[model samples]
Target: MYAPQEDTELLAGALVEEPVPPGADVLDVGTGSGALAVTAARRGSRVTAVDVSWRAVCATRLNALRAGVPVRVRQGNLFDPVRGRSFDLILANPPYVPAPDGRGRPRGAARAWDAGGDGRLVLDRICREAPALLRPGGVVLLVQSALSGPEQTLGRLRTAGMKAAVTRRRRIAFGPVLRDREVWLRERGLLPAADNEEELVVVRAELPV
Candidate 1:
């Protein structure tokens, strides 16, 4: 399982900036390590965290317990475990690194980062499904490398009738994953040669009340 990294920290920072009402219903999608989920629960939101990996689900439950907060953890694909439920707030830090070639979803640890070409695999699905899970006046927060098209994410969420925008952005040196994929990323025109800095952006989409 992928550990908490730059994208995770960026999203967590955005969560701090968002105004979540006390005892709000919160859903955390792909809650790897449970960092964000625990924080939300600590802030008094009733939390449900979900991950596709059993390992991650287990980790989240353990972390929430250690944090002395109650978090309902589940194992399932994004949004599936919480079907028919609407949330006051939602958060995600999905895998979004662009894969090198036509390798249908890498089967190992790389599955946490190797998204299909254009890196829209999980991002697109999140944009499509998350809006429905949000209650009116509720917001969804997503963090991703700028390589995966934050503008496109904004467009997709806006099309779904939410006011969507990049709420937070951080430019940091490429991590090991990006450093390793630099050549292929350049070849795909996703990154420029000699450009070592990548921007991570937090997208916020809020439905009107």
Candidate 2:
């Protein structure tokens, strides 16, 4: 089975080093395999992980148990399951793949990987809704792709009235999504004649008091 990737691990480690107040409540949006939620719980945060996929929710629960941490895993879209709920910290590794057609997402798509066209569908919603779900002085951690550009994500957060910054970044090898595309393009003679490397952009943004 396809499992949680290294970017998830990197995002978890980044959250561990951030200033999370003791016993802070944390929400892990799009907790695909629950890696980040488990890490936050193990670090003493009260964590709730939300995913739209039943499989993801189950995976998160099992992963949390394996990690010996208690995390509430919920199944719902975005913040729907936790409406009226606010948290001290929110972490999300949302789907941000920009589709080639330049159109919106299709129905019943993979919530963890498909980001619709321009790869900003999920990121955009998170930015717009996060402020309403965050406590004063809360912080949000987001890990997306450079395909959508770092500034674009930051701009959304700023427009949402949150102070945002890029705290950490590391180049990651292109995963299956990009790999398949590269193969298709090569077969069609559309790929560049030279070597190419794809990278992911992991960013952390905070909401000020």
Candidate 3:
């Protein structure tokens, strides 16, 4: 399971700023450790956290219990376990790293990162499906590396008829994963040859009332 990192904290900060009404239905997609889910629960929202890894689901459940919060945790791919359901708010901190060629579908813990060549393997799907899961006036707060193309996410959400914009951004130095893939990323023009930092962005898209 993926642990909370800079991306997770960035998304969590955005969640804190959001106005969540008591009893609001909140979905924490790709919830690795249930951090965001618990945060919402603490605010009086009914939280449901989903993660593809069963381990992650268990961790979230345990964490919520330890925190004295109620979080309905599920194990499944994004939005699969909650099909036909809508939420007042959705949070995602998906895999946004651009993986090299010959890397097939991520297995085990690698699923937390290792997105496809352009790094939109999971991101594109979220853009297409998340809007449908959002109720009227609902919002989606997604954090991803700029290397994956934040503009692409913004365009896709707007195309889906949501009011979308980048609400937060941060420049963090390349972590071990990115540092190892530095050569490939530079070759793909996803990163600058001289730059050692990657910009993380939180995109907020809202369904109109």
Candidate 4:
């Protein structure tokens, strides 16, 4: 299972700035460590978190338990587990690394960051589907790597008729995964040869009420 990292904390920090009504419905997609779900529940919102990995699902439940917050955890891809349900808030920190191949499905821990060649495998899908899963006036806050194309994400969400913008950004040195893929990323023109840091961004999109 993926542990909470910089992107996780960045997304959670942005979540704190959002005005969540008491008992508001919240969905956390790709909830790795259940941190976001637990945070939402602690704010008195009803939370449901979904992960494609069974291990992640178990981890979320365990973390929620330790945090003394109630979180409904489910194992499924993206929106499958919450079909027909609309929520006041949706949170996501999906895999957005630009993999060398980016064709086949990623396995094991790689699932936490491997995306297609352009790093939008899961990001694009979230943009397309999140709008439908959001209640009118609800918001979806997603964190992604700058290399994965945050502008593309913003444009996609805007095209979906939602108000979308980048709310927060941070630059951090390359982590293990990115470090390992640096050569490939540079060759693909996704990373600068001289740069060792990447910009992480929280893109927030709101549905019209």
Model 2 stretches astray by more than 4 angstroms:
102-109, 183-195
Model 3's TM-score against the true structure? 0.99
| Candidate 3 displacement at residue 187 in angstroms | 1.1
Better structure of 2 and 4 per TM-score: 4
How high is the CA lDDT of each candidate model?
Answer: 0.91, 0.80, 0.95, 0.94
Order of quality (lDDT)? 3, 4, 1, 2
Off by over 4 Å in 1: none
For residue 159, model 2's alpha carbon misses the true position, in angstroms, by 1.4
lDDT of 3 by residue, 76-118 (tens): 9899999999999999999999999898998988899989999
What's the best-to-worst order under TM-score? 3, 4, 1, 2
Model 2 gets an lDDT of 0.80
- List, residue by residue over 1-209, the lDDT tens digit for candidate 4: 88899999999999999999999999999999899999999999999999999998999999999999999999999899999999999999999999988358788889999998899999999999999988899999999999999999999999999999999999998899998989999998999888889999999999999
Best by TM-score: 3
Candidate 4 TM-score, true structure as reference: 0.98
Q: Which stretches of candidate 3 lie over 4 Å from their true place?
A: none
Winner on lDDT between 2 and 3 is 3
- Could you tell me which residue pairs clash in candidate 3? none
The sequence of per-residue lDDT tens digits that candidate 1 reaches over residues 37-90 is: 998998999999998888898999888888899999999988999999999999
Q: Put down candidate 2 lDDT per residue, 25-135, tens digits, no spaces.
A: 999998888888988888899999998888888999999988889999999998999999999999998887655563446445455676765678888888889888999
